[model samples]
Target: MKSIVAVQFIAAVFFATAAHAEDLEFVLVNDSSSDLVEFNVSPASSGNWEGDLLDSGYLAPNYEVGVLIADGLQTCVYDIRGVFDDGSSVEDYSLDLCDLGEYTFLD
Candidate 1:
């Protein structure tokens, strides 16, 4: 009976830890002009960014692209575009996640 109780307690702890992970996504766009441009998306907390090329042949005016944020950190998105490109744009949308408080186990 004691062994069964110990196994149940371990399973409960594992499940609780798995519930706190978060995932997020955002979109980027170009609003004006018909020129080829390149842009990058980055996580504000980690300072890690990825670059994508958006040229006249690949991207259209006012086009949107989606990006994914990794787990275990609070993230904010940013838009990095070339200056030669003409357009007004916005970035930095965040995902929603649960807040974990102190936990207690009882008999």
Candidate 2:
């Protein structure tokens, strides 16, 4: 009986940790008139922008891709930036990615 209780406690702890470490995922869409050459995201509290998530790939106009934020940060607010092939860039501040299931960048 003691061994069974210990196993159950371990399982409960494992499940709780798994649930808390889940990754935040969302779809990124390009609705602009140009191709997106760069896509970057960073926590709202951090002033620095991380590397591009595209990894040498480009999102053409009217296209979309799935994005996963696995940084394990606690905050849901983030800053998103996209650079277009037309030499122009756009940015969004304080976006709640948890509630934003999908994001579309418009021209």
Per-residue lDDT of model 1, residues 1-107, tens digit only? 01111111100111122344454443433344543254444444435544443323233444444334344443333333332244433343332212211111111
* lDDT at position 51, candidate 1: 47
Q: Between which residue pairs do clashes occur in model 2? A: none
- Expressed as tens digits, the lDDT of each residue in 1-107 for candidate 2 is 01111110000111123336556677777788999998888878888877877766688887777787777666689899999999999999999988999888997
lDDT on C-alpha atoms for all candidate structures: 0.33, 0.73
* Per-model TM-score on C-alpha atoms: 0.37, 0.79
The Cα error of candidate 1 at residue 98, in Å, is 13
Candidate 1 at residue 100, lDDT?
Answer: 15
**Candidate 2 Cα misplacement greater than 4 A, ranges:** 1-19
TM-score of 2: 0.79
The model with the greatest TM-score is 2
